[model samples]
Target: MPNCQTESHPPATTTSPPASKAPQTTEALQAEQAPVARDWRAPSQQEIAERKKQLSPDQFKVTQQQGTEAPFRNPLWNNHAPGIYVDIVSGEPLFSSKEKFESGTGWPSFYRPLDPQRIVEKHDDSYGMDRVEVRSKSGDSHLGHLFDDGPAPTGLRYCINSASLRFIPAERLAAEGYASFAYLFPEVKQVLPQSEPTSGR
Candidate 1:
């Protein structure tokens, strides 16, 4: 739910009635119009079946069966790119590069999510470990676990599975229909287009 906001302009004269609501920021407006506004509900039985066929054996196992991939060897563990990570199943934006950090855990770790609402945390007591399990709200895919040991700002580590996510580089956000999130990288100055949503890999 963390978002950017522009500074407000001077207030209107008290003589005239103030507007009922404040003006929406550019980010807010862009979010409302973003292609991500499409329905991102839980996958149905048929959808799940289709996904099983579309996804790789490792991806399906980790995301659908709650299986974990080997650490350090996963695709994104050492990734240092400027981009966003989204739910592999639903394509819902989950984490940004801005929050990513090396946790020495050999997994892709983040201090927080791009939008907290897109993530669901549940008490996990599996394998004799008391932890919090992170899942994608829309896709209902088992992402990974959360731990308290982390860096500043947010003292929480989202230890996620690479199989459960798809990385979209900053420059390709607009083309990938995630233009609203382009603001996360101010250094990449590109006119983000309003593109149609894509079915994630």
Candidate 2:
């Protein structure tokens, strides 16, 4: 008997296939390119309390207690300067001087807020009258009442209280941490000095 021992064949090498990437959906691509959302949440109770402590009695009343300031007597009511109004409590941009107009309401009136999303409107049924009340989205400050009696276009009047706002003058926008809005004011071109009148002599 011939004992023939056949050599076992060497095991074949195995290789893993490359992974296939799944195609991105339209929604995913859109989300990736979308701008990051801003943090607009309200402040904590402690922060609110601290802000209240720093506010004047009038400011505290209008923002915290939802009280109204006298129409013609409040500051900023007749302010016609180029600037933006911010939340007294949260420093959130609310309205711009360009939107403000003479509404004869004796209060700071605007056709619309700087950003409509920054304002929260609610049905205010107090005092036996139905009115739309506007509030700061982040600060939750009671701005004032909104009425339909306004100029063309929006036909909406935001009759806001001056006490609930802090004005950031255009000249001081950068110094006051609002430099992003500095574009609202363009630099005034210097007029060339008039030639001396010696020619007339």
Q: Model 2, residue 31: what's the lDDT? A: 34
Worst 10 residues of 2 by lDDT: 1-10
* Best candidate (score: lDDT): 1
- In candidate 1, which residue ranges exceed 4 Å CA deviation? 1-49, 189-201
User: For each candidate, C-alpha RMSD in Å?
Assistant: 14.2, 27.8
Sliding window of 10 residues with minimal summed lDDT for model 1: 1-10
Model 2 over residues 54-121: C-alpha lDDT tens digits?
A: 99998888788778777567788678888889998988888888778766556778766766767888
Write down the TM-score of every candidate.
0.72, 0.70
lDDT of 2: 0.68
lDDT of 1 at 175: 71
Error of 1 at 82 (Å): 0.3
Which residue pairs clash within candidate 1?
Answer: none
TM-score of 2: 0.70
Task: Note the clash tally of each candidate.
Answer: 0, 0
